[model samples]
Target: MKNNLKKNKEISKEQIKNYFTKSVSNFRNNFIIISLSILKNFRTYVYVILIPIAFLMIYSWYTNAYKGDFKPPELFKYMVIPSFAIIFLVNTTVSEWKNSVFLKRIHSAGISRINFFVSLYIFNFLLGIASFLISVTVMSIISLIYFKPSNGTFFSLLGLLEFNDWVGMLYSLFLCISISVSIGVIISGLINSIALSQSITLIFVLFSIVFSDCFLPIDLLSLSKPLTYMSYFVPHKHSVWVGLISASSQEVSWAFENPERPGRIISFGFNLWIPCVTAFLYSTLLLVSGYFSFGWNTKK
Candidate 1:
């Protein structure tokens, strides 16, 4: 711990002050230490990083065993997307307050907390996007080894939307993750324990899993329609839906609906657009609430 503390020191004030006066976006002004600090803390733990990685590998197996090409997207829509997104993105905000020395010093550093927080958010956003792409790439690569993707096939799921098309989805997921992590950070920040951060994280996972439609088919649960519709507003569910593509999670729709091996197809109109809109809205609502929560309770 002593060595860790000694390693985290920034350069002298003279350099920072001089660099600040010279330019806002200079390399010195935009220090890499912050980024290094984040990586050092978040990636140092083997378990934290590997859990998501193992989950992705499991997802690949599930996708590979799927009979239809589109089923890969279905698995992602229902399971992999939400699970992986939550694991990585939530790490940024949720586990922020484990260290007494760093947290206290940074909070009292006389710098703008909002700016500090925003820089952290930007890193999480960029990391989430990169991780998302990497997971999809890994899935695609694994799918190629065991599953064949033909014309308009499973791999084409990547091309289902342009980068802009996914902007809302990514933003929505980011906000959901941010809100969750922020709440955890506030608790951890106040309590100053790593265990508390994880405890809160478990509760959140329970909440998100319960509310998320990924647990069981939200439509097929045989619950009352009104109740089902009511549950759709939950933030994590909104995140899962936000990042969903146009894929159905059914084996053979006609086999169940028609009892014959009838061709099944997914409709793009409501299936795609609805999630895109709702996720953005839900994320916005959660983020707005989180912003207030962070201000009111996170600082101690």
Candidate 2:
């Protein structure tokens, strides 16, 4: 009995040492948990649940996008962006926050709050990249099936509706998800209840939809300039912009018969780079904040 107790003590000490010495592991674990949660509870997700509806929605907008002002794919891109913002990050982050003792347990294990944050930020970054690819793949296949490739015109990155723009949109999704997840982590870290987490996540979604140009273009709603600027701070804006870019790609010629709508207009006025940088930076800052929140002593 004495030997058994001694070995168990040594094992506990080693675990503590691992937590303190290798903070990266904590972040990796969180990242993994976030991803698993996404896969695990896809049923609750609107995208996953109503994918047929989403597919139909994407199909309609993509078909309508053929209008000279916008291509079917481009318009559909707009909806997809906000959809991702609301569904993926909100559901995953909030759920994890409420259930996981991620923050408290880490500190108990001897990992520093700052170190945990640093590692999680990196993990979130990589996680975003994976989500980007997954989302794009789903969007592209569904859109192309309906739109049918025309003259093999490739998509461009900056043009809002080009092949390259698709690539940029993919990156934008990656950036946006990171920002969203980071925000969730911070929110979860601060609040103790799953119910609270869900509410906050919903608010974030509402804010994102409002800030996005999809529902109310800045030109149309001149008063929202400040909100538009504020939107820059949110990942939802950038992610939506990327979708707009993919939709606006000029190579396909958005309108089938009516050519009056200017090409690349969506990409013209918007400062696409703002969302990119903001999402990247804000996510990092919030991720760190979440780490600290997790570290707060709970025995109080």
Candidate 3:
């Protein structure tokens, strides 16, 4: 009896190891497969989306140059990068689901549903980071070539490139992108039609921008107590606040205040780390929700 018990323990240990090993293998294979799909269709993506946005960014900078310095436009700040990242990811996910034939094939091949969702999330998250880097690099080059600070100080662009601040800013951006990607995945997984999914995601992106403090100042929320409380729920508000604060050590009170408009003067006493943590938590929550909510079968 003792010998049999010992043998059972040994078998259990081997089973645990095998389970972990298989999980890792599934994750790796799924990630690689999705990544390869993105690369294979690179040109279609570039022409359809990337190139047009790049030109729009350039034009935005050029127009700003005429007005004063060559700081990136507000559109670039609050919309372009985040919107593009979300759209790209959500589209990719929904497309896969929409392709019934492909979905049936993959299901027949016995791929784990959890692995598929995780791999898709990771692919989009990494791709979002890459897109952010490319956008930053392009803007920096444009600044170098065309931008001239009115005061002959590089402070405008310096905030973006400074190491310590840049690290914080990058973290904030990553959190934002991660949140966006997770939300996209959730939307795509829940919705059945590809076009409908895209439309819903687009509306969500627009709503986030319009309602969030990114375009509208937090001070605007002061007009209504309920609205002010609601603004706290907006993900971009935290991200934008963290990003602006991280970019400069100087009090960012100016960003939230407008003397001409005449509103309540709120103090900038909030800790920067709060938003960073909040955004991360939000992303994790969305990812877990998407994983569970995602359907294994192709039929809605």
lDDT string, candidate 1, 124-195, tens digits: 555555555555666665556555545343456545555654564455456555545444434444444456
Q: 1-300 in candidate 2: lDDT tens per residue? A: 999999999999999999666656666665675456555665534443354346445555644633323343444443354344434454455456446575456567775556555655555555445544455555545445444444221132123344566576566655565656566666666666667666877787667755665444433333444554566665566656654544555332341232234432333244455555655666567555656655343232
Query: What is each predicted model's overall lDDT from 0 to 1?
Result: 0.49, 0.52, 0.61
Superposed on all Cα atoms, the candidates' RMSDs to the truth, in angstroms, are: 10.7, 8.7, 4.0
- How are the candidates ranked when ordered by TM-score, highest leading? 3, 1, 2
Candidate 1 TM-score over all chains jointly: 0.63
Alpha carbon deviation, residue 244, candidate 3 (Å): 2.0
Q: Given candidate 3, what's the lDDT at residue 255? A: 42
Task: Give Cα distance to truth, residue 118, candidate 2, Å.
Answer: 4.6
Error of 1 at 13 (Å): 26
Q: Given candidate 1, what's the lDDT at residue 282?
A: 62
- The local distance difference test score of model 1 is 0.49
Model 2 TM-score (2 dp): 0.58
lDDT of 3: 0.61
Q: What count of clashes does model 3 give? A: 0
Count of clashes, each model: 0, 25, 0
